[model samples]
Target: SLDLANGPSLEGIAILNIPSIYGGTNLWGDNPSQKKRRKAQKTKKDKDREFSNSSMSSAELAIAVQNVGDSMIEVVGLENIFHVGQVYAGLRASGKRLAQCSQVVIRTRKRV
Candidate 1:
């Protein structure tokens, strides 16, 4: 299960939007059911990294931004939008080979 409970939180950031595909109403609406099932299996490993009740604050998560995407930029909060330029910073900080994370997909919390 892709345990959203364990994923990073966007509490302090100004959320612009959460992908509709990830929202409750549109679950699996973007893809065929078979594809969704396969993706679910692939993302299951990420559940282990989900946020815990004692999750670190945004500052603490700063270091983690690097590990966010394989190659594509994927900022997940609204405050992060202000630092859109820093997407490069995140790429450099992560230092992981871009080739390894080329399909980066940043998700955002819906702007409210």
Candidate 2:
């Protein structure tokens, strides 16, 4: 287990991430375009592979999400990680908008 009071040192840590085409559902929700792309994944994957090798040069979100996610794995707990789409769906299922559920997160984090 990780010790929160003695979090990992990062004084000289460096992370490198190669940009790749994203295939996950969007944060808010999936749309028709995404559904179509997902259904034809073999073709889309080939195109994504080409584009990633040729034109994808940005890794800002890729790097940051990896860094934060890696570091927080223990803190957040192994079974607690979830995609935002799933969370949004759960909140919507509960008859509350994601924004309303997000306020609960904000307030919880404030207390944390």
Name the top TM-score candidate: 1
TM-score of 2: 0.16
Worst 10 residues of 2 by lDDT: 94-103
Q: Please report, in order, the local distance difference test score of every candidate based on alpha carbons.
A: 0.30, 0.24
Model 2 error, position 3 (Å) = 31
Backbone clashes in candidate 2 total 0
Error of 2 at 9 (Å): 32
Model 2: how far residue 21 lies from native, Å: 12
Enumerate clash totals for all models, in the order shown: 14, 0
Model 1, total clashes: 14
For residues 1-112, what per-residue lDDT tens digits would candidate 1 score against the true structure? 1223345432332211222212222210122355555665565533433333333332223222233223433234322432333333343222111111123333446764
- The C-alpha RMSD of each candidate to the native structure, in angstroms, is 14.4, 16.6
